[model samples]
Target chain A: MDMDMSKNMERVMKDKQEGLEEWSTIIKPKTSVWNLYIKEIWAYRDLLILFVKRDIITVYKQTVLGPIWFFVQPILTTLVYIFVFGGIAGISTGGIPKPLFYLSGIILWNYFADCFTLTSDTFIKNQNIFGKVYFPRLILPLSIVVSGLIKLAIQFTLFIAFYVYYYFQSGIAPNYSAILILPYLLLLMAGLGLGFGLIFSSLTTKYRDLKFLIVFGVQLFMYATPIIYPMSSIGVTAKEILFYNPLTHIIEAFKYGFIGEGEFNGLGLVYSGVVTFIVLTSGILLFNRTEKSFMDTV
Target chain B: MSKVVLKIENLSKRYRLGEVGSGTISHDLNRFWAKLRGKEDPLSQVGQVNDRTAESISDYVWALKDINFELREGEILGVIGKNGAGKSTLLKLISKITSPTTGSIKAKGRIASLLEVGTGMHPEMTARENIYLNGAILGMTKSEIKKKFDEIIEFAGVGLYVDTPVKRFSSGMRVRLGFAVAAFLEPEILIVDEVLAVGDIEFQKKAIGKMKDVSSNSGRTVLFVSHNMSSIKTLCDSGLVMSNGTVSFKGDIDSSIQYYLGNSKNLNSFKSYENLDEKPGSKDVDLLEYKLIDKEGEVIDSFNLYEEVSVQMKFHIKKLNGKIYPNIHVLDKYENYFLVDTIPENEIPKETGIFISTFKFPKYIFNTGEYSIGLAVTSFPGSIVHFFENPAIIFNVTEDDLSLRIGPSTGMLPGVTRMQLQTKTLKI
Candidate 1:
């Protein structure tokens, strides 16, 4: 009877051991550079969506005009740009209406700037939450990108209203290429913003000086991208220097597609696309490496 | 015979001490250059053990070193240690909030950690919305939160203020709501830090009960870190003690507590009396030595609940005209006096010399807990305190089987002392 009881106990223990061995997760100090774990990110999609919603809703929760600030912000910036660049400086808008010309560039620039700034500050701003819980660290920056897109969609509608108003006033139809290249332009903008933001976020954890540089650097980059002045007005030497900037082609392409009035270079756009891809890939690699140890340093 | 659900192997974490940004870029570049040249990184060899009191000779220090343990299924493990003992570092590593420097952890199921209460709560968001946000941050799905929504509100007792902004809620209400959500997480493995100390006593009790239910009834594992010994003993099955970034002991909860309390200030029962300049005492008497001793006449800092123990005190007198008697004040862990033992004036000394006094405590006097002893030497007739020392020695008391039968299954009785009361039955 004793031997039989011992055998039964052994079998029960084996079953319990087998039950626990069915599912396990192993945590290690470093993961391979190639293992992006896209499936894990996909599993956490709901969390990503909730974060996006929180960012958008909480930004204007207490303001008197609430979300109307989304439209009012771009409208006010565009008015200032038209006065300062178009009316005061007599800058040519390639024959497009001044408001229409300036609002398009301002709206798109605001989206990129907002996305870049918010995403770049992810590691510093969310250190408390990150230090306490385990979730995909990428979710914070990805949600910032998504929330910035939502704001852009709202501001883009305002741009479209002016686009229609100018189309009748000038009787100039938008180029057919605008329909085909709009998605690509937006993708390029997002890729560049996300890429640069990731790189900056990872670097700033170690050295905080970059955090101060980014605010002024974005404004300086805008002048180089032909936001206020047309590309046709610049000399050959200045144009060549501006062509080296990946954003230069994207903005030029956006203006050509929507108003049918700027220079179009297929090779330059291809170069911009290639550069964006490289920057984004390297950015992700740096970000993954930093997320493992940023808490210790930050 | 339970299955091992979590295994940590040779875990270690090294950190750089002092300024975070001083020449770190040059260090990084130097390490990179050395790596490219196929040479050693130079800085990895100089790390010392994590001792904050010592002057740092190198920039690197090991926050944790060679930690290895296996936790079985449904086992509630209590981690107890002093500040800077790397308890939080261990939790952060297990939760994957930070990575270890040299080892790996294999866990069987989903792990959720409440390292801090209301970690990601946004003040601008309403209480209900903050619940969803905090829950999502803790790895719960939106649908999972929805399923437990009403229960969370009911448990938090904030149904009327659900729509109010979290900033407007009282701190107590916020803690209640935060703990309510975390308690309902239902993960396979739960890790809790010192978050339970935030709420009121009633909520703390409820939280401990819910933790017990989660581990026992649902067959989940739990890792709890706390400085509160009573709650740790009540909620945990086993315990791990950390000292100087290493696991000093791992065993059943009772002995672990004893070992932790005893070895906290070095393995010694005696504390040297020094620095009389700040002490409140008359120059007529000076305390020399104070310690607790077992029945074997050997120095001890811990005892069983029913064990006979003694307090040995040694003092010197510069001049004595009247009899000097010794009085011992026994205080509980919270410093509440429960007993005072004093000798008669005739039993004391009247001559000027060094003296020794031993006081005996019978069995069944002290219940299961920690007690600190204070000593006072006073004159006779007028009974003025010549010299007094508070908390001369501290000791721990463990529960005995005989005492176990006299109380609830929770292992403690209602009152402080366990007396031998007489009872009789009358024919009626």
Candidate 2:
């Protein structure tokens, strides 16, 4: 063992000297922002699936309701909103039944809200592992969004059940026009949530003051979004103000697609979709830059 | 020549060392001023002497200064340093977890780091789910993870609990599962920092073995940071010794080890002797200071396979009641609790004030490592009236032929006892 180590040690010493000289002369530290974000993240798709699965399982684990909590949370929250906003406050639902009315907005909104809240603080929460490892940072928020989708799926099943029951009771159903736009609406909601969430995640890495802002801001944002009352219920001036909130078109379109009673304008939907695209693109760019050096700030 | 896979050049990192939020406003103002001056940064003052006590001294200090190195494919690089050294900071920079304040790094292949096992394992997620999640965070494809899924679970040894949520798993189990996923990951460049510090002894060994296999078998480059010199000698082919935020030595593991052990050994005795004063000594006398130095009058940081070092001692005799003999004892650095003591009874004296003694190792046949020296004054029979235990006059031994032969993965032999032996083979 001694003889072998000595020989190896000599070779290593020679190599180290040569390596240092070579490194000093030829190496240039440059980061490929685009390649790193898209390619590296694409490779780690398996981990994302695991993260998504972990999110879904852990949320329900040890609870008596298990996976049923996914269904129950949206159902219960929607029922409360119906009592408070629909029955007591006399908020209009654009002629859709209150349970169906609130459940559609609540389920879709829940997915976006959860994605935003989880992804907004990605670096702060994952600082322990992030400091120690080298992997694509975007994978953290990407996995959160993916995992949120799984929960959204579970809740959507309950929404379908409620829709079917209401359909039989009223002898009315979602028109073909509404059914065709369901996938698009889902994508829009995810894109917006992911974009905004990543923007905050990047900012929170440095300031940390943004964390409180995000938590409180999201709560107030819930009111601005057409989740509780349909867009049609608001007067003309108030409707114009709500139209400026990009989430308004998203939720309004989702309700209109499901219940066939809420307002949906092409110009508004296009404007919101464009906003989602820009937000997501900028978010990705910021997240890419932030992930590289959040260790120093966070 | 082997392929060079990773290169770092002129890398320097500046860190604000005190009061996290206090520097924010100053940093922003500096940034604004720099922009006004059309310069990159306003605070680029170099060689401004570090008056650590003064308020005018900038909070910023270079965490790393002109660090440069390269690694061949399949080579395991051991980064060794004391606390506040730039070892972890180097890893962070290479991993892109943080950017360098100045300089650049170029790596040829995909890198995966076990910076910490289970970085983002959601407590609510099952082990099975967490494995996937952690894998993704590590940049492994689903198919890649699936292929290794069974192997990972088996390696973690968690068995049927793979499907259970990770929060339910014990800390050890969580670590095991996390390590299993990370170790199974096959990236082109693998970086690990003191991760083997976790789990039981057996698991640590297993983790080290896995790291070795990853680097050796797959031709992957590995960068490992650790304070355990023995482990560095056992696991790394090359070494980078960092001191005070600079690459003090870089080369063959032996030379780097020699440089590190040498620089640190001299300081040990001073600290130990200073600390020894805190322990109340005999009423009559006190052992104030102790140290070890070499033939050239240099403090012996370490030794060769067969070398000599001198243990020098000094003390003050407040008032001597009777005759007392001085004794010198030696211990391995890792095991300073016990010692081998030799008394100079014949040289005893009834003292009044200052005293000094020197013990020599004419042929200090110790392995290349760290050893501690202790000093004491004893009465005629056996009772030690005053002593400074492990008063750290330390040294390391280096033998080029011997270290290379031991190879990587040998357990870190912690002391000098490995030195006091000889081996021979006789044919029957």
Best by lDDT: 1
Query: Worst lDDT window (10 residues) for model 1 chain A?
Result: A15-24
| lDDT of candidate 1 over A7-70, digit per residue (tens) | 9999898877675665467888888766788887887888899888888999999899999999
Clashing pairs in 1: none
Worst 10 residues of 2 chain B by lDDT: B271-280
Please tell me which predicted candidate would have the highest TM-score against the true structure: 1
Q: What DockQ would candidate 2 receive versus the native complex?
A: 0.31
- The CA lDDT at B127 in model 1 is 92
Native contacts retained, all candidates in order? 0.76, 0.59
DockQ values of all predictions: 0.52, 0.31
Question: Per-residue CA lDDT of candidate 2, range A174-221, in tens?
Answer: 666866877777788888889999999988877778899988898899
